[model samples]
Target: MTSIPNVTLNNGIEMPQLGFGVFQVPDDETTAAVATALEAGYRSIDTAAIYGNERGVGRAIAESGIARDELFVTTKLWNEDQGHDATLAAFDASLDKLGLDYVDLYLIHWPAPARDRYLDTWRAFEKILGEGRVRAIGVSNFQVAHLERLMENTGVTPAVNQVELHPGLQQEELRAFHERHGIATEAWSPLAQGAVLGDQAVADLAARYGVSPAQVVLRWHLQIGNIVIPKSVTPERVRQNLDVFGFELTDEDLRSLAALDRGLRTGPDPDTFN
Candidate 1:
């Protein structure tokens, strides 16, 4: 099994850079997929309360026979649960569903700027962090503006910012901002949901490296230092995704992949997502 490297968050919490994600994964299939991922040596598992598969993810963790301290589990607070009291309640509910005393990381699922309640929601996150119920706190789908507002208002910087990132959506400016602020950049939909797999540049690199196109793209993410979670229920693909540790992309290859960026997003825009 390949060992995945860990990225230290702003809070000094270590998180596996190459992990598993259960986004659109159905609850019924999540357990088996997560179990396979665990067996494949993926120590990080990212899910959200809205995904409705926390129970299944928890079940897999329980049955994996791995020690609780050895695995990193992450879940999010849903948009509906976007107030101080409601966010606290939602955290308890998510913990109950995951069957864990605490999650390794918790995130505000989105800024929901239109709602204008994320600042209040973040206060709850700070409280939870202070209570030691979560190892780290973060935000997903948050733009630089949202981050700036949160920092200015609450005086707390998120440990990580999980966003829609891939070869097609490089997010250069946002990533530079994160680097300056010490916030880790995590990529969801890292492969562009298979859209980048067939690109001629990606295909050519895969051939050069003797790996799958998916692996090529994932390797690029690793080289770029983005925490990437590529999801696939198939056991073989699950293993394949983590097999990126062996190859290194050259500067020329990196340049080629950089050219593939077209400012595309596989999900909603954070500034407008309500």
Candidate 2:
């Protein structure tokens, strides 16, 4: 098994820079997917309450017989559960469903800025950490404005901000802001939902490196110092995604992909939605 590198969080927790994500993966399919990822040597698992597959993830980990400490399990608090107390209540529910004593990471699923609840939601995360029920806390789909609001209101910066980052939607400004703070940037939809997998630039780079385009994409994220959790139900792709550690991208190659940024965001804009 190839070892994926780790990045230390501001809080002094060590996190794997790459992991497996289970978004839109149904409950029935999650077990096999997670099991395959585990068998493929992935140590981290990212899931969510909204994903409705936490039970399957917990079952896979329990059956895999890997020590809980050896595995990094992460889940999130949904929009409806966004206040301090409600978020805490939601954590109990997620834990009940996940069948675990604790989670390695817990995040506020979205800022829900319109609802104005993330401030309290982050407080709940702080509580979770104080209780040692969660090792680290973060946010997802949060932009710079949302992060600034969170920091100003709560005085706690997230350990990671998982967002939609592909070549098309580089989110360079937001990433720079994350770097300015102690927060680590994590890439969701790291393949741009396969949007860039067929691009000529990625294809040429893949050919040059003797790797798949997906590996090139993952490599780009790692080279930029972003944590990535690429999702795949296929076992071969599951194994292939983690096989990105052997190769590296050059500065020129990195600049070329950076040029492909069209400011195209595939997911809904959190600001407009809320």
For all the candidates, what are their Cα RMSDs to the real structure? 0.7, 0.9
lDDT of 1 by residue, 1-274 (tens): 6778899998889999999999999999999999999999999999999999999999999999999999999999999899999999999999999999999999999999888999999999999999999999999999889999999999679999999999999999999999999999999999999988999999999999899999999999999999999999999999999899888999999999999999887788888888
**Residue 132 error, candidate 2, Å:** 0.9
* Candidate 2: segments with Cα more than 4 A from true spot: none
lDDT of 2 by residue, 1-274 (tens): 7798888987998899999999999999899999999999999999999999999998898889888888888898889889889998999999998899999889888888889988878887898899999989999999888888889878567999999998988888998898889899998999989998898999999999999999999999999999999999999999999999888899999998998898777788888665
Candidate 1 accuracy as TM-score: 0.99
TM-score of each: 0.99, 0.98
